[model samples]
Target: MDTSPYLQSRQRLVPAPPRAVFELLADPAMHPVIDGSGTVRAARGGSPDRLRLGAEFGMDMRLGVPYRISNTVVEFEDGRTIAWRHFSGHRWRYELEPVDGGTLVRETWDASRLKHKWALRVLGFTRTTPGNMERTLERLAAQFDGGATPS
Candidate 1:
């Protein structure tokens, strides 16, 4: 985990291989299915189905109000890691580590570059991010383990 105070992370050992997990992470269309916060609605048009470093994707979101986020893939390591950033300047990252016949997935929300970091905290994001991340991992695991789809 990052030592920076502006970063929060959650992890889980999922019964899936790194390649499998990475495929989901690299696909923008799959994001809403694994999102924990329920804010992600769908992948908007013009976004790539599979993302790579420097690729851009748009998502429809609703958090009290409907909105759209255009995100750029800023980091990529094939089956190991991927990260993206939006207009907020914050980043969402996923790291995969092979362990004990499964993959240890670590998701991080880094707001260190945000111009108004305090505003996010004031909005309760700081309080809810960790739990949301945990749920995201659970949803991801279930997607590969036979479970209900996001509705």
Candidate 2:
């Protein structure tokens, strides 16, 4: 487990209604839809279908090759908040809030105490790092703004 503090990103999007934004962010099945990054390979069994608190799912991504992680919903409130923690070791969280035009989404990642050390070394190569997370965030914001890029 990494003890270091996690990094976070808070973004606001306009256009997508609370219901639409909530559905897109809350459900795991929509991963590929808004996640233009091509990350989140597959869910635990297969499809996400729907999401609820305490629910667990599998995710795969390609930094350079491929990496997989399991995640579970830690907390959820309809059209309010949804928090998830990484189950595969790393500590991560995602929080969503309803806004005037759409919804505000925040994502965080923590890998402070990586004993592997090797993983830290690899992260040093920022050039080859994955942009899936960023791309997904942008897409969500755009989709929320009725497919318009927010300023």
Clashing pairs in 2: 2-112, 2-113, 3-113, 14-145, 15-145, 16-144, 44-58
Instruction: Name the TM-score of candidate 1.
Output: 0.93
Q: Model 2, residue 110: displacement in angstroms?
A: 3.7
Q: Using Cα atoms with residue i matched to residue i, what is each candidate's TM-score against the true structure?
A: 0.93, 0.68
> Once superposed on the true structure, which residue ranges of model 1 sit more than 4 Å away at CA?
1-5, 149-151
Q: Each model's C-alpha lDDT?
A: 0.90, 0.59
How many Å off is the CA of 106 in candidate 2?
2.4
- Runs in model 2 with CA error above 4 Å? 1-5, 44-48, 112-118, 124-133, 146-151
RMSD of each: 1.8, 4.7
List, residue by residue over 31-141, the lDDT tens digit for candidate 1.
998999999999999999899999999999999999999999999999999999987799999999999968999999999888898998899888788878889999998
Best by TM-score: 1
Once all C-alphas are superposed, what RMSD does model 1 give against the true structure?
1.8
